[model samples]
Target chain A: MSTSRERVLARVRAALTDVPADEPVVRPVERPYADSHGMGAALEVLEDRLRDYKALVRRVPADRLAEEVAAALERRGASTVAVPDGIDADWFSRTEAVRRPDSRDRPLELRELDSVDGVVTACAVAIAETGTIVLDGGPDQGRRAITLVPDYHLCVVRADQVVDGVPQGVRRLDPARPLTWISGPSATSDIELNRVEGVHGPRTLEVLLVE
Target chain B: MSATFLGIPPFPEAARAAVNDSRLRHNLRKATHTIRDKRGAVVTELEDDWERLRSEGAAIKSHTLRHLDHYLEQLEASVERAGGHVHWAADAEEANEIVTRLVRATGETDVVKVKSMATQEIELNNALAEAGITAYETDLAELIVQLGDDLPSHILVPAIHLGRAQIRETFLAQMAEWGVPAPEGLTDDPRALAEAARVHLRERFLRTRTAISGANFAVADSGTLVVLESEGNGRMCLTLPETLISVVGIEKIVPTWADLEVFLQTLPRSSTGERMNPYTSTWTGVTPGDGPQEFHLVLLDNGRTDVLADTVGRQALRCIRCSACLNTCPVYERTGGHAYGSVYPGPIGAILTPQLRGMSSEVDEALPYASSLCGACYEVCPVAIDIPEVLVHLREEVAAGSGHLGEKAVMKGAEAVLGSSHALEAAQRAAGAARNLVPRHLPGMAGAWTDTRDLPDVPAESFRQWWNKHEKGQS
Candidate 1:
């Protein structure tokens, strides 16, 4: 029997017989769009966009990062926080919550992730124009479920990691790894096209922007 | 729970009923207008580059479609290399069978689903149910539609036709039957509703071992499938499941990874009118310890080749399903999605459904005429699909096909009369002389056209006669 793959490809080839034999398979596409908006205040812009999505954003200096994270988690009353593999231990040193570290060898169970009060992780890249933070399952970010299953997400973004636009953000990432690009907490406009936040994903997205 | 678009009335009949519906009209108007304004505001923010980005998006899709076979092979090879199995499905049945078998192979009867147009188009959920395998729709809108036993009206918001009150009622009435019961005091507040859905679906996401999804864009170079969504259900389904199956339309391919820059920038703005939707998940294949352990990609053709066959019609394949066209369409805003009677509705549906399904059915034939050809859809389309051009092209195809014998005969006679000056003048004179004898309504099937419209009164004399008299000074 002929494989469906062969049959589908055959149909496709048969359908496109009009193309010239010499036509290049890949042609240069014109991109007149700018690579970057060149908004020099990418951090401020990122903050504004993040706040616009109702995500709580706080900027702190490098030395105050751990203190701010601890305060934010305390404010949220998060008693149990899931920490990814490579997240700095110092960042949670001042926190009162018990740390549950997730690693490849000893990953947290789905129930444990669900039961955790919050999750803390680092991002791969942040897009200023869209206010999106991308996680590529890096050691610091751990598995995608760590930030997802939990109701609260405390993502740390560095000032240096922010890109001015989506194009710049896309160019900086590797597609081979699984990536979760989150702009805000999960939202929906399904009911009468009204924007409603905090659905399925974490309800609270608190970003600690370390300069 | 088995709601389908099958056996729906044709566009004219369906649209007439829809237009008369006051509540549906109010909901559609409010929703479409809100999104339209939001889209305008966000799109204007990129005023300097929006058009260029849209053109670039169109060019990239065109380039990919022209060499689709090459890219499909590349995508398949890349996916396999990334430890994901690739299955080719010629049509809906093949795709559904493959998904069902894959689920059964895992000995799992239940699978969580991200909102996917491809799966909806193939009715995968229905197929799974037939095999005694239940598929849970995890998207809030999809969940509402599934629980309410309703067909999806809009592409982005499947239950766009239903208001918040209706949703709360649905949850209160049906949530328990599905899984978790809705809270007793659940109000119609959008936040409370969203919270209810989150709480209800959380258990399923954590428990369901298998998931099915669809891709917004499939990067051929990297074998990456990207799904941009506002809610996190997509992330849960893509991440938590042990075995992931994505049934993707073949046309969802982008030639390169860098090409995502064009679509990612345009899609969110064009879709939910956000700078970026809340969540976008991208996965190439199975990651060892991070996401799904096993991944299967089913490439679906299902009339896409037929769509590709027509050079003019092939542009419909460029659609990203952003649905900006639907929100901006005047005809769509009034009649809403159900009138088009396809999973895809609005201007895209008018051209797309007919091409995908062929113009054999009354619904398909009427779809090409569903538009006023106002060009609003083309203006807002992120990929720049010239919807009006396709509508006219499809109209011509539908007209040339079988049926409409009476209309065809009338057109043929009128063609001869209008083709010659002598015949036209004589016919005009005859019409003028017999003006009083002409009935207001035509006989038989021809009356259908004049039923809701008035026939133009015959002029006392044709324009040609007046022109001749003035030129000859014989007025």
Candidate 2:
């Protein structure tokens, strides 16, 4: 059996063959003002855009992060939360809600996470221009099922982690990683052009932009 | 896959029949306009570096296609490493045979399906039906199409051609034949339609142990297959089945997980005009007892390599099936997908179907001329596939064939006149003398051009004569 690593390398070699060796690896393009702005500015812009698209956005800080998350959970009346392995233990140390670690949870166990109030995890990268957050099945991200099962998800992203463009973000990731990029809460607009959020994945996504 | 464009007709005949269907036109206009407006607004809102992203998307796809052989090898290795089996099929029949055999091995009579265009393109469900295996379409639009016994009319919204009333009727009449019957006293209300569909599909989702799917993207690095959908049905299909068979086009490869970053932004915006689709499902073979226990990915060629062989036409392979091009295309907006006479329709279909199937069939030959060449499809294309360029290229191929007898005659006459200045001068003089006899309307072969459109009143005077009278002396 061909290894995943070998497959990735072979594709990379093939894709890159046409590129001139001397060409700059990362070419910068002029993004709109909202895209080129710094993380804080971009986050606000994203908030506005999301609101325009009818998605709700809430902001929280690092020091009060756990309490705020707990409060958000309480507001939604969640009984349990799916916690990724890489999430800082301190984030959940103060919360009273039961925790479900992604690694140990089976489908049935994960289904319980869906009934629980919400899911909380850290994002791999967030694109400010497009209002997107990417989650690789990294330490903090956990299995793909955890975040998807819950109705609500509170994804935390550090300001430094946000990127202006997809290419810049792609440069930082390894091909072998399992990446899930999200822009807004899961949504479908089949009925008379009226959008219904939370069809399969999280119905509500609350991003905690920690400065 | 064998590149054979067999048994298809030319565009004029197909479009001639379509334009007469007023209901189809109304359905198309409503659907395309709504999607076009939504896509435009969302895209404009996320206009930050849209062009850059488009270029990046194109580049990534181009890079992947160039090294597809390598990537396929890598993806196979990764899936195997992850305890998954990989099978390759050269054409639709081969793919159908392989999938049928796989399902037979599992001894399953029914399989739930995720919204997969690849399977639709190859008509896998029908093939399975011939083998006495039933395939249930899980996506809402797909369900509508399947229940109606109709072809998909749009890439993103497969049942865009069906209105609420029509859906209500189709559901009321057809649901019992499939498995579940629609709720009694069903109304034309959208909620009722959705609820009936929901209750009906939920049973299948819960019951089916085998599922078939098509991937949005396949990451070679991790042997991961990704599927993006608006509904949770795809998730259920991918996760609930005991044996999951994913039939993916070979062109749907991305080198790494990171490469997915570019597409995630481009696809949702370009397809549904949303910031992101609700469900983005990714899996690397089997995950022990978590999802499907036995996972199989059938890598389908089905004329993709033939598409790859053409330098200009090969770019059609980079399509993410976003359907932005379809929504914005004027011809597609009017004639709809049915006119193209293939699974793939609209701008991408115009270029892709011809290449994959070749300019052999009347339908395949007619596909290249289906577009108006207005470049709207090119502008909305997330990957920036110069579809107009490809359309013209395919047109040239079609024109070279014997089918375009009238156009060939006109071209030959024009070439002869243009080849010699004296011959052109003689023709221009002859045209001036014959202006009265030019007949406001042409007969027979040239009549179709004036059927729906006004033939430009044959210029009162030839351009050469006018230029000579006005500016020749000044020069």
Candidate 3:
């Protein structure tokens, strides 16, 4: 029998026989939409959008990020935090939580990460309009597992990384890297279509925005 | 019994039972209205460019479908180059066989699954069960369907037909048989129900060696596959599994990365009424020591090429499976989803099922007439599917079928009578003379129409006669 690949392609050709073979493949479509919808300052919009989703949002001066991070973790009463390497070590100096740094050669097991109280990581880019933060497994972000398995997530986003909309965020992202876009703590609408926060991933998401 | 049934009766017959089921009617009404209201509120907040985004989405899809052969080949080559293996399956059977074989080769008996419509279209879970591999559905809604032994009713929330009380009962009664039992004293609260699911699926995610999923979008320029979900269960399945397999339909492809701007803005709001979902994951291929080590992509056709053949019907391929049309459809709201007898239910199904599966089944033939043609679906469709146009087209096809001979003859007679003045005049005179004798319920073929609707009383006088008798009217 002919391979499924050959058969499927033949069917596709038969299906689109009317679409001229010589016809141009890339028909220019008009994306007349603005690059981003700017309501106000990106930082202000980001904080408002994040708060709307019930996520804890805090903005602090760049120099005071370490103090803010320590305060947030203390507020959550997290005793242990899974931190990625290359994250500024000074950020966790004030917090008494056992800082377990993720290792590249010996990655933390999912169960071990699950036992930790929370995770602290840096973001790749943040979209202010949608209140989304993208993680591309950059040095400070670590692998997808460390952030996912923990019950709480404390992601630090710099003011320079924030954009106004999804289009701008996409332009800045490298598609080759695995990307995770998060808008809020994990939520589900499956039960009678009720939107309830806290289903699977980290239930509490605290964002420490540094100007 | 699971809404998970197959080869059922025609839609009208099936709908008769659902229309009378007060509980289902109540459940569907509550769920659909909630989503509809939420969707309306968020969409109204858009910055005057929602229409532009919709048009951009439609144009991008149109361009890709027209040149699908080229884009699909590019996708396959790119995926292979990115350290992922790709397989093409011409139909559901071939796709199921390939997936089952892949599982068999892994030497594993159990696998974790993310909520995937493509796999549901092929009934992958059932296929895997027959092959002696138990696939655990990790999504909260899917877990409800699996435990309740029900078919998915809605695309976004598969168990939308079951209320909270019923969900509590399902968890209490069925959790132990599957795995970890729900905590005792569980109530109908949504938060408690979600918590139980999280704990129940956590163990499976940790232990399962294989994961299966479907992609919401596949970018052709790169080999990336994107899955959007609210709960973290998808994150667990995508991240923790040692090997990952994704089955995606051909129509899910986009030509480039930039096109995501259109869908990303529209899908989350249209689906769950959120500015953005909680978790959206995009992966190009297998990365060294990250996520899944072995990645496989199954490109499924399964009658999509057939649907794409009809120039008029192929527009159904543009569906992003947001379920916005289902939530807004009046017909869908009343009958719920089970009446449609397909995984894809409601307005999208009315056009898509008949094209994908053909008019051979009575259910497929009846689906074309399931709507009131209110045009609500067209208004809400993000990709601009002209639903009424496709419904009328499908109606023409159904009307031309063998079963409709009697109705066809009656329509032809009515047309001939209306065409000539003499035939019309005579018929009107005869009807006027016997107006009192007309039955409220007609017999035989006409009974199908009169059974649910009262036949109109024959008028006492024809319009032409009234016009001819009025002198100058103004006088």
Could you give the TM-score of chain B for each candidate, in order?
0.89, 0.89, 0.90
Tell me which residue pairs clash in candidate 3. Answer: B2-B149, B2-B150, B3-B151, B4-B151
Ranking by TM-score: 3, 1, 2
What tens-digit string does per-residue lDDT give for candidate 2 at A112-189? 664677788998877666676778777787766677667688888887887775556656655445556676765555
Of candidates 3 and 2, the better by TM-score: 3
Which pairs of residues have clashing backbones in candidate 1? Answer: none
Q: Tell me the spans in candidate 3 whose CA falls farther than 4 Å from its real position.
A: B1-3, B409-443, B450-475
Q: Which ranges of candidate 2 are over 4 A from the true structure? A: A1-42, A49-56, A61-126, A133-143, A146-179, A191-194, A201-211, B1-9, B41-48, B179-192, B410-443, B447-475
DockQ of each: 0.80, 0.20, 0.77
lDDT of 1 by residue, B342-435 (tens): 9999999999998998676888988888888999899999999999999889888877887456667777877998899999999899989999
Alpha carbon deviation, residue B132, candidate 3 (Å): 0.5
Off by over 4 Å in 1: B406-475
Query: Across residues B1-475, which tens digit of lDDT does each residue of candidate 2 receive?
Result: 1111223345565666677789888877887777778888767765566777788788888877776766778889999998899987777888899899999999999999988889988988878988999998878788888888877877878888777889899999999988889999999776667767776876676678899999999988889889888777777787767899999998998887766767877898888877667567777877654568899998887777777777788899999999989888888877777767777888999899878886667678767777779998888888889999998988888777777677677778678889998998887788778777776445666654433343465566788888888896787
Ranking by DockQ: 1, 3, 2
- Give the top-scoring candidate (DockQ): 1
Q: lDDT score, residue B139, model 1?
A: 93
